[model samples]
Target chain A: MKGMTIIVKTISSWVKVLIFLFGIYIVLFGHLTPGGGFAGGVILASSYVLLMLAYGREFAEENLSLPVASKLDSVGALLFAAVALCGLCCGAAGFFFNFIQQRWFAGQDRAFDLVSAGTIPLSNIAIGLKVGASLFLIILVLSMFRPDTSTNEKE
Target chain B: MSVPLPVFVAVPLVTAFLLPIFGKKGKSAATFLANIATIALLVLAIASIGQSNVYKIGKWPIPLGINLVYDGLSSLMLLVISVVSAAAMFFSIRYMEQYTAKAKYLSLFLLMVAGMNGVVLSGDIFNLFVFLEIASLSSYALVGFGCQHEELEASFKYMVLGSIASVFILFGVALVYGNTGSLNMAYISQAIQKSGLNAGLGFALGLFITGFGLKAALVPFHAWLPDAHPSAPAPISAMLSGVLIKALGVYTLARVLFNVFGVTIPIGWILVVLGILSMVAGAFLAIGQWDFKRLLAYSSISQLGYITLGIGLGALIIARAGKDITAEQLAWASLAILGGLFHLANHAVYKSLLFLTSGSVEMATGTRQLKHLGGLAEKMPVTRATCTVASASIAGIPPFSGFWSKLILVIAAIQAGFYWVAAIIVFVSLCTLIMYLKVQRYVFLGELPENLQQTKENKGSMLVAMVFLACLCVLMGLLLVPGLRETILTPAVNVLTGGYSYSADVIKAAGGM
Candidate 1:
């Protein structure tokens, strides 16, 4: 996939990949550090924003549509609700109760480890998905209506 | 009994940060996740009710570190926030289609909810200010979600006033800290009790009243509300009008006045005056509105007045314990408060339903002007039915939620020998009825507009949202039934009547000094 991309007129293609990877890193480490779903999501969307700025709107549009983004938003919210509902199913009293605390899963040691803190890790991932998709989709929708600078200059 | 109150704030705080990662590809996943967070919050809120708990943040004890307090009042507010946000989130599934940035909107919405939940649960005064700002700032941005000329203008106005209110609250907090040497509300209350209200405390109280009054959109400070509330999208309008003002403005004012500073006669009278003024002025202003949502906004001010009056009257009755007034009068005062809270919840549900229905109308017919909209009932049966239920409830028609609450308020007023206040309550109810009737006649009962001849009902999640709130409005009266009343209203009322005992209760519950 990296070898196939030869269309960027400015900046190395590796830079874009690096930026995307950094965004993913932020999202994954959200719970452990300052950057979580919202920050990480915005970071992820910026990669696409960079792609649009570098590769143009056509490339972005071919990859994602407005309706598809809306659907992602619905699904993300539903997933968040479902995670909370798990607590209720276990008779733990409320949504998002830390029911997993009693169950011992592999790799669930350490205080700040992803899966160690019960529902926090799962909730964080759900939020990251919602925020990332929402940001990117909004950017796409905005970009679709962006004025053509080339045409404006010609006119 | 030993639950940490901070979890309410911490969960959403964490989730809000985490939601953005899925980016464009995971928008559906994001929405699902946000819903789950709120549902979890809802369960937490319900489970926490009737149980008084305090969690000191960072394991630091109160007076040194911030604490979150959950009592009847906080639990009640939490329940209202959860129910309304859940409905709003469900509605947003389809309603947010016309707008872009669905994820950003949801994140902000959850943030606002988290802020309100925090405000209600926070035992620290300064922390309340922080949460209040979080909620207010998000709301201001949300109001202008459309970025249209009107929405932008309204958002700016709301931001300006809201910022000013925040400043006032912060100033009040600073004064309280300086005067009492404490940021914890219970500690401040204890300090005030030790050394009664000094001039600085007095000034703080005045500032608090003005700040929260502006937030509540009381009569004098309500200019921005009409424009701001109508400008937002439907579910947003619902959330803002339904619970935002009550949670941030009214509930905070009641908590600070009753719990922190301690209520006095002069302060009590001031609240009563503000309440009555808001009621009369809000209803009168609402009667003249041609826009459907704007009318509801004005009515919100009026309804809030009832809550303020109920609480203020309770304070006055307690403060004026003399040879003339007896314990029965005190009980009557409590009854009045119970009525006010009941009305507050009822208004939140029905008002939000009304706004959602208006959104549906606007979505279908492309306009919200009462003059332009006509006979939508024929086309949009679901909206029409829901609107009818909400309108009847708001109008205080028999068997609907509003009527029972209003009745209780009036009866309490009369029993407490506040006959004039009772008359005023009835007068306001009549005006409310007239305004809603005008809405019904112009928007639903009149001849269908030629342009809107092909209007159809809003289907899917929107219909479900409206139906849910409408059903709640009708069934809410059942809350007055003996068994249910003991569970919900009595617990909430006990929290308020408990007054200064709140501190002791919290300390005892936490096994502290």
Candidate 2:
């Protein structure tokens, strides 16, 4: 029974990883397509939920503690804010104001590079990170209150 | 002048994320950091006033790249948002101790603030929707933070309604984009002005009114408010009633309707009708509530109605131009709007203070049902004192912030030839007074309950927070004085008065690049 449970948990974990990767793909392509940070992050968080459901609370907690996830969430928000702050400090007009007019990389003009989109790509990535972490943290914390069924059933 | 507009959103957004890291152990530290962030924002807001600047999100020029626009209106909103959030954050430092996930609560609170700030500053309609969702979603989760049956029920109800509102807004944005081929508000306004009023623009306007109205909890769409406001924790309640609704709903509505759509007569009348309905209905419903917070919540809807009426009336007068209305009439209408905006700011302070007082009372005696609460004045002096000031303000007693705004609104109504509306304002003021007196009589004036004999005042940060806001309630009336009025109120009014010129100003500030 223990071996079978371990195998099942591993398979579930792999599946979650796959789902998370797919969600990242969606988030990355969000600006150009339909899916953005919010939808993609939710998808990513749902993968964690699936793992928790398949393996149990303890399994999920061990891999993704609430504190750790929350910290990541904060960092993501900070990264996003920091990008905007850079715009502010650079005299770029205001927050989230992308001021980079052109790009010169490796002695070549890369004005149209994906990274050259200024605050758009940066904000998108930041939003993706913050949304994913926030959803994960919220889900994890809320799940901690799941009632003990055996005691209630016996009572 | 040099402040980046997006920092207003980014700072809180970053801090909100960083806040949860403190966990249970570093909750106090997190709280302090959050307070500092809000204070920083308050300074920035104050500094940014009277200045108009635009930041292109990715170094790209208008019509292609997203932007954050900062001007008189956005700065005013930023100031209100920061002030309310700071006070609420300060209150939560002590109030949230009873709850287990203190850090998580702070995180969510900051996220909501970040979202509101973004909504106010966003230059792009699609970006506004994104921020609106962020704020709405965070508030939904915070409302359900307690996870009790009532909290969850309210949260679920709020979430359903709120999500629907967001979808409406998103659909509106998509429609506008399809019609104008631009998402930038300035570009859209320019397009609308160039194209004239088309079916698509009119439909978009209707969708915006519905979406923002629901978000604002205007009379027709106010069902979720009474249930949702009183369900959250006291600080969250304060934020929601005090700043969240104004920032996410009223401010956005006014920005879009006035600056973006250029405020036609029909739209203005629609706003006035909505305002009158909310004012009369909300006040009447509030008078019957026994739940202390619920009464306050209902009152919020009513007060917001007055603000809408003032702005809408102003827009109507301006649209009519010269036939029956002069520029003075327009000014008078703005005076009404100024009153509404003033009331909005004042209400934020006093209402949050009231909620904090309610939280203190509930914390001490363990009940919020008015019948179960009585004569704790001697027991909880700080709370009783603050509650009295806040209640007096809400009741529109002379010398309080609420009175000045209500008086301005009434005066403006009468001057604008809307004598009945003026009379209604006075009548509603009386109704508000009666309801608050009932609160005072039931909760503070009567004999102390036997079960609450040992109830004591909340100390530390909670008392500090209550005192801070109470002091403001007494002093806020000074905002009408010449220097202060010129500095604060006039700038805000100018933004609205600038009308369609707003798009021109924004484009100009971008150096017409």
Candidate 3:
């Protein structure tokens, strides 16, 4: 598919970074806020979707690419699993036990702090990455099935 | 013996994510890793045969956090799932070679396995729904993995129906939670026992039955099974029919009904009616199918009917006896449950084995239509022998596994004074036998087709997988022996027959925190 109008392209390129940063903010502060991994991740993916709509499929793909997105997807899942496994292995607390909260952040007044919720924030980051990459990949793959009218028009 | 319950889910879940990273060139390595994951699950399931434990996720107490409750029924289901999965994975090693993107197939396969394990082990209602969706979604994708026109259509149909079933289940979960103020199954049961079933909870129960019934493909809700099961690749078809319906449908239904709702006469009779309808309809419809896999799919619906009938009969008796359940009544009820649970395990082995044989035949002869094939008993000796074994087992022939389970169901039906039910069970068995007879005569015993004269047996892993399950079919009846029965089957029966006592057991096992 071809790019949209130049105005749309110019506007999206500027707005995309802010949107991505906002997603990161939501993810990092997820443990304290209502919007956590899933919500934040969708926002992250939406930034990329914006770019795809403006600059077209090829440019969007060149920015993140299918392979990189796929790899990131797998990596995100592995990171989440790794965090859970660490909890299982490190402490006698059980699978998904918050070792970081118990051992490192035990006692004291870290409750409202940004770094307080132990594995929760880490898990949020992992889920954010996974959801972001997964949504991107899904849209990219679905875009591949778009009708070939653009190529035909060129011909 | 008390293996951590999460390992059952974790091993496969971790491996599934790790797999696709291997990409195209790493297909063999990915398959090897996937096989190892399934075999590990099998070993763990075997070690956990007679054990029960409750693992609380995140070290949280019951009612506050999700728990994995591994009891007799879970153990039994786990064993069946792992055995079938292990064999199916082995079979897929060679069978899935026909398809491209082998890594993605293996990944989806493991994810389905993980989801099933989670479903069987989950102690919380919402947790169960999440896992149920996981398993159902993967199966839908796998069904259309080949991307053929027919396969895609079947997958779409399956997906739409399955999503509706899931929505119904989620609504039920929400109702139960809203009424009881808890998502933990044990707490919900205890609350129900105390407050009893109000109108809302009663509605939830109905929703649960309809939802799980759809998942189980029980007669009225069984429109998707024939197309979906046949359209998938053979090993997947085996897994879908053999264990997926049992784990996601019947097992969850039984868990929710007996353990949570605590079984009333109305519900019991409802189950009986559904069971009888499925048995009669599935059998009549299956007898006329031309496609081999489609025939097996319909037969799966029929065999599943036997399990539902057995469980429903037991529930009816127990509900009738009420608080004054006598020794004899309890015996009859447990016997019926035994038959159902035993049939469940037996069906898992033989049905999957039968599907594998169909795969073998298809791989060799390039057709699943019985009309184009004949007299393969001469050429493919091993496939014929194993197929005969599975067929005999499924047809309720004596000394094979299916006979014992059927015998138990018949005896229980007679003892409980449900003579009509007993008659129907026997009649279905006869119909099952006739269908298999047609399969044998047309596919193996008749004159070989001209083009299929050079057809050869599938060697290596596929043969190994078929033989493994075939051996299990012959020996599974031994599980009914007194010593083995006490360990493996009896506990599962007790869990169902014990009714609301499940809450007491799970809470106590959770250390009453």
Candidate 4:
């Protein structure tokens, strides 16, 4: 399909950056707030989806290629798993996902702080990355089915 | 020392994530790492046998935090899963090379393994459901990996039924949590014991049976298995047929029914009927199939019937008599459970081997149609030998693993004074024999199709994987010997026969009961 009208494209270009930033904020502060990885990740993915809607498929592909998105998805997941493994022997009882501040941060009493909620924030970041990449990839791939886009262009 | 429960799941999850990074170019490295991860899991499973532990995740208390529990049943399931998965992974090292995106296949395979491990080891009901979804979703994608028309069709069919089952299960879990105010299995059991089966709980139980029975592919709920199993890559077919159904469907059914809901006579009898119907229907249907993998898929339903029947019989007697049963009845129940558990392990090995051999045939000949393929015995001796061993084991020939499990099932049924059940079991055995004989005749003994004259045996990792399972089929009878039985089957039987103790054990492991 043709790109959106110039006015729509121009507005989306400015608004999309705000959406991406808001998603990052939510993921970073997930442990202390209502919004978490999944919520934030979808917000992030929507920015890209918005880009595709306004700028057309080719523009979106130019910005974030399929292979790069796929790689980022895997990297996000691996990062999550790695974070879990790092704390495998650190839980108070030595189980997985034990990100107690005292265990790694050494007896610091930093409650209600950004980095004080143990491994949760790190995990949230990893999940946010994964979910965002996955959603973006899904939307991009699905968008390839349009009448205006040939299958070869998807590759 | 006991291994931590989370590692059972974590290792594979980590491996799954890592493999995809290797991508299109580093396929060999990806396969090598995947193989190592599976072998490591097998070693871990074997090492952790007879050991039990509850790992409190994030260091929180049981009711507050999710925990992973590994006990007799968990260990048994872990053993079966890792064994079949290791073999399948090994086989796929070579078998999957022909398919593009081998890295993604290996990654998905490991994801499925991780999901299965989580399902088996999970102490919380909702955790089980999450893991179940993870495994089911991966298997669906893997089934349609090649993106062929038939593969996509089969995958879609399997996905629709599977999703329906998952929805039913999630609904049941919701009902359970709403009723008991808890999602932990042990707490749910305790609450149920205190309150008894109210209307909501009863509804949940029905939902559980429908959901799990669908996953197990019991007759009337088994429309997807024949199509889905044959469409996947060979090793995946082996994994799906071998342990996925048992771990996801039958194991969960047995666990929830006995340990959580407290097995009742009615539920027990229903399981028996379901088992019998699946057995009879699967056998009759399998006999008429010309597609080699389709026949194996039907036979999976038939063999799963034996496992279900054995468990159901034991459940019937135990549920009827409770803990105060007579010694003879208890003996019969334990024997029945033993037979069921043993057959479960035996089936995981032989059925996977059977599927892998079919895979070898397909890889060599490019088709699974029985009529169009024959005289592979001369060209593919290792595959033929492994296939014969597997067929013999499944057909319940003398001294094979299948014979011993069947013998135990018959003896248990007779001792329980269910003579008709024994007769039906024998009749099913005969039908199984006939079906395999047909497989042998058309697939091995008949004239070779001209198009397949240049077929050669699949070598390397495929051969090794097949031989490993084939040898296991021959040696599995040792599990029935008194000393080995004490080490293996008895522990698993104790887990089931002592169902009332499950909550107590979990509570004790978690802390003061």
Candidate 5:
């Protein structure tokens, strides 16, 4: 299906990229600020959703495609889990998340810096990627069943 | 050796993400990895048996940090979850081959396993709710995996009810945090003791019973089980019926009621009434169903009732006790709880085994309706044999696992002067016997349907899975015998019977308050 009016498409094309960049900022600074993986991820998903609404389905598929989104979703979750597992190698800290903040690697002196908060920022970025990929996939799949105009069957 | 508790949840979560990466082509490798994860959990669970520890996340102290507490009850639940998951995953290796998205299926399976492990190992209320939602969501998707008309309808029904239950639990957790000013269960227990039940705390407990009770499918809240359990693929049916309800519903309910709230007479009576109602109503409803898996689903509610009844009886005795309580009464209460926990373990094995056999039957003949199946004893001999063993076990026949547990329950009821409860218990066993006999007569004995004539026994991993559980059915009697009881059943019972000791146990394991 073709997209909306030329004016809406032109504005969305510009605005969506800005939304995408803001989402990255939220995820990267999750530990320092209130916005974390979940907030950042939703923002990221919305940016792509805005593109799909402004441009047609065909245009969006040509960019990221389905397989790439699916693979990226899995990669994000795996990355998050891998960060958590890295804590297991750092002595008797518990399982799901035990980041290494002390032991000579990442010092506590520079707590406010981007590299601080042990694994929280890394976890946030991974979660942001996962949430963005998953939400986009859900939207894309739902869009496919929306009465394909070229076909005759009543989807 | 004390296996790191986080490994239980981590291995599955990691593998769940990794398996989906295999995508469409590497299905065999995906299944292999999934099986390895479940098996490793089972081995770790075995090693962690009878071992108790508290691991503080990031080494943070209690009341501030989330600590995973491994205790008697946690280990028992861990043992049950791992055993059934390992068996179910093995069975799914071949059984799920017919489904198109095999990799996605395996990933979802691992996700469900991770969620359950988290539920089992979690030491706080909020994290429990999080893990509970993860497991429930994946299960809802898995139930509709076939994408058939019935499966979709059933999945939607299950999801609506399940989401409501989750909301109730979350609300209760919010109220708990608000009232007690803590999220850690041990701290909450201590706070509740220091300040008795206020209005908010009482309301929270009410929400908990309703939420967990709905998840467990106790009578009035059981509208979804009949449709949902039978709609899923067989292995999933086994997982839901065998362990999901227990870990999500019974375990949490028991933990909160006894440990956090500290059982009172009113709560004890409520549990008793719910137990009896579920038993009688479930049995009555089950005896009339012709769908093989549907019949088994109703039977699950009924069997769960017996466990609840035993626990309730024990709780009643405990709550009624004064400072000078009699030794005999204490013994009776302990016996009741022991019966309940024993039945829980036995039922997990036999019930999952029964579902697997039913799956084999369905796979062979392409239907689960009893009227449509007959004389499978001649064609699928192994499935028929395993089905018979499971049937006898569930019906409380002597020498099977169910008989021993029910016997303990009856003896405890009679000893405690609950003659009517004892009578009802015996009467229900007869009802159970009649239901399974119906299953045997219609599905295995009567004239074979012409469509099912070509049906043959399922081979490979399916057979291995069924045979392993069938052996367990015959051997579970040894669990109640004198020596083994000390290690297995006693610790679990002690956790409940110890009652107030839970707070101290947690504090001590965490290296002090």
Candidate 6:
């Protein structure tokens, strides 16, 4: 597929980075704000989607290849699960116990800080990475199907 | 002994995500890792048996935070899911070799297992739905893994219907939350017990029945099963028929209806009627199928019918007798529940064995059409023998697992004063026998076809998996022995019989927080 018009491509190229940065902000500050990993992930994916729309599939694939995205997806999920498993070893606190919050802050003193919620930000980051890569891959794979022009032309 | 409940969901889940990183060159490594995960799960499930605990996630108290409830029923279900998954994973070691992207297949397989474990252990209704989606989405992908025309078509149909079921379930959950202000099962049950079944709650119950019934593929909601089950590869066929439906569909229905909402007369009869309908319809449909796996798939519906019938009969007895019920009625009710739970375990074993046998046959002969293959008894001795054992168990032949459960159901029906129910039970058994006889005749006993002349038995892990389940099919009847029954089956039965007290019991188990 050919690339879109110059204006569209230019605007998307400029806007995509901002979207990515905004997504990172949402993920990092997810504990205090409404937008968390999933929302941030969508924003991140949409940034790529915009690039794909403007530059075409090949350009986007060149930027973030399929294999890399796939690996990133797995890594993100593993990171989340690894974080959860870490809680299992922490002195009978149970799975997903927020041990860092309890040990460092002692009660709800750090409730309003950026890194206040123990493990939440980390989990959100992992989930954000997974959701972003997964959505990108889904859209990329779905876009692979094109009309069979030769068959249609023959008919 | 204190195997953490989260481990059941975590091991498979982490392994699922981890497998994809191995890529193409690491197929063998991925498979090995996946096998270890499932085996570890099976070991954990065994160790955790006869012990119950409520693990509050993040150590949050019940009613306010998510909890994983491990009780008699969950333990039983976890054991079944682990056994079938372990067998299926082992079988996939060789069986999935024909397909490309074996790592992805294994990943999806583990994902499905993780989802099922989550569903079984989840104490919160909405969390159960999330896990249900995870399992359903993966199974949908697995069903279409072949990516052939028919496989894709079947997967689409399955996904559409399954999504509809999920939507219904989610809507029901929302209604329940709106009505009771809680997503936790224990809290919801308590609220219902306190307020009785209001109109909204009753409607939510209706939605749950429709949703889970669709998931379970009970008669009216069974259009997707035959197509979806046979289209997948054999190990998947086994997993789908063996544990997926029971874990996602029937188990949820039983838990919600019996434990959460508290069974009433109308609801009890609704379940009984649905069970009977599924039994008669599924058996009749199955007997006519020429496709080996399709026949088994239809028979799965029939077998599931027997389970629902047992549970429904128990519910009806309890509902009719009510609080002033006599000891005899209570005994009958417990017997019915015992039959249902026992049949659930028995079916998971034999049905998965049956599907694995079919897979072996399909692999060896390149066809699942019964008519194209015959006289495999000579060529594939192991597959033939194991298939016969599974068929016998499923047909309720004496001394096998199926017989004991069927006997219990019949006795319960008769003692509960439902002679017609007993008759139908016998009738279904007869129909099941005929179907398997047809399978035996067409697939094993007849003249060897020219095309299938060079067929050979599948060996190694596939054979081992088949033989493992076949042995379980034969020995599962021992689970009914008085001493053994006290440990597994009785506690499960007590959970259902306990009814409204489930909330109290769960909260108490959670340290009364």
Report residue B469 deviation for candidate 3 (angstroms).
0.4
Best by DockQ: 6
Model 6 chain B lowest lDDT segment of ten = B504-513
Q: Against the correct fold, how does model 5 do in TM-score?
A: 0.97
For all the predictions, what are the DockQ values? 0.06, 0.51, 0.81, 0.64, 0.63, 0.92
Model 5 lDDT tens row, B1-513: 878878888889989999878878898999999999999999999888878888776567887888887888888888999999999999999999888998898899889999999998888889889999989999999999999999999999999999999999999999999998999998899999899899998999999999999899988899999999999999999999999999999999998998888888999899999999999999999999989999999999999999999999999999999445688888899999999989999899999998999999888888998988888888888888898999999999999999999999999999988999999999999999999999888888989888887888899999999999999999999988888888788888888887777887898888756
What is the RMSD, in Å, between candidate 4 and the native fold over all Cα?
2.3
For candidate 3, what is the DockQ? 0.81
What lDDT would each prediction earn against the true structure? 0.83, 0.85, 0.94, 0.92, 0.90, 0.94
TM-score of each candidate structure, all chains considered together: 0.79, 0.89, 0.98, 0.97, 0.97, 0.98
| lDDT of each residue in B424-499, candidate 4, tens digit only | 9999999999999888888888888888788888889999999999999999999888898887789888888888
Q: Between candidates 2 and 3, which one is better according to DockQ?
A: 3
Interface root-mean-square deviation, each candidate: 8.2, 2.7, 0.7, 1.9, 2.3, 0.6
Better of 2 and 3 by TM-score: 3
Model 6: per-residue lDDT, tens digit, A1-155? 78899999999999999999999999988889899999999899999999999999999999999999999999999999988998998887788888788888885677779978888999999999999999999999999987669988888
Residues B120-162 of candidate 6: C-alpha lDDT, one tens digit per residue: 9999999999999999999999999999999999999999999
Residue pairs whose backbone atoms clash in candidate 3? none
Model 2 misplacement above 4 A: A1-67, A83-106, A109-155, B322-325
Chain A only, candidate 4, TM-score? 0.87
Worst 10 residues of 3 chain B by lDDT: B1-10
| Candidate 3 per-residue lDDT over residues B1-513, each given as its tens digit | 468788899899999999989988899999999999999999999998888888999899998999999888998999999999999999999998988999999999999999999999999999999999999999999999989999999999999999999999999999999999999999999999999999999999989999999999999999999999999999999999999999999999999999988988998899889988998899899999989999999999999999999999999999999999999999999999999999999999999999999999999998999899899998999989999999999999999999999999999999999999999999999999999999999899999988998888888999999999999999999999999999899999999999999999999989864
